[model samples]
Target: MSATYDVYIKKLTTQELGYRKGRLMTGGYFYISKSAVGSFFKELDKYVLNDFLRLDFNDPLEPGNIIQASYVYHNDKYAKENGTRNEYRIYHNRAIAKHQLHFQPYEIVVFIKDGDDNYRIEHYTRNDKAYRILENIIEDSKIRGQHALLQLSEYNTLLNV
Candidate 1:
């Protein structure tokens, strides 16, 4: 079944850096760092403003889904023996020609549902890290058959959105 939700993005406060810190459109506040805000806007300008971003939420893991988001896998054996090394693997659908340039690992990816009812990767981080937290969250969401809502608190966990 298809679902619709009212999504809003807000800058988070520094004091509470752990929690998701946002309400369901009520009176609660969400906090994000100034640098994060700047990065988000910069991504927006590059992706949304340039019309490269689209939101197609048919099924993130489905092969038919045009947009695919994944993470770079760091093999422990390779890392320990050969020094740090990583490999990017597409988690959901296979990467097509259109998404070859954008779909990558170690980035904070934001998948949105566009006006045409298509899904796309909106935002992502540039740096690659050992821990693919976002990719894990997305995989968990697929397993649970629900949207992933990341909780950035002391006990960082993925909540169903």
Candidate 2:
């Protein structure tokens, strides 16, 4: 069977960000940001905005629904709390994404920024158990010394329209 996921873009309206304040991702809410948003847009069309939508929702997001809100936009603080310090050592440090729903076996990693003015990635799995499975991917990447390639899929927010 083939795996599938839900993906969409959320337009970042001037009303959302406003002239001075940028958007922020509240606890579980999706908010806009000033710094990283630009980059997010640049890569929005290639990466998975939300979670892996196709991972069967036996438990369901809500009480009866099969699909749950798996992923969401991450604010600076929340990202810092869940992510490693080294990963977000840049001027505007934050995790690009977060897994809000529970879906086993699948792991989601979102890289934001690094100290060397590079990039930082976030890893979000179905649960703690999947960490090991994801570790290998990370290890292999590190061992191969390959730079992670992130493309734009569909952003939860739309920057242009």
Q: Which candidate leads in TM-score?
A: 1
Q: Return the TM-score for candidate 1, rounded to 2 decimals.
A: 0.22
Off by over 4 Å in 1: 1-102, 105-109, 118-120, 123-133, 142-161
TM-score of 2: 0.20
Q: Mind giving the per-residue lDDT tens digits that candidate 2 earns over 1-161?
A: 22221221121222222223534332222232222333431212112223122112222123433222222332333334454221111111112212423111224434432222233334344455544534543444422221222232422122121
Query: Tens-digit lDDT track for model 1 on 1-161?
Result: 22332221221222222223432222211222222222221122221211222323444345455543322233343435444433222233334223323332223444333434354443434443412545555455432321243222411232222
The parts of candidate 2 lying over 4 Å away from their true place are: 1-60, 63-127, 142-161
**Model 2: per-residue Cα lDDT at residue 140:** 46
Cα-lDDT of candidate 2? 0.28
Q: Say which candidate scores most in lDDT.
A: 1
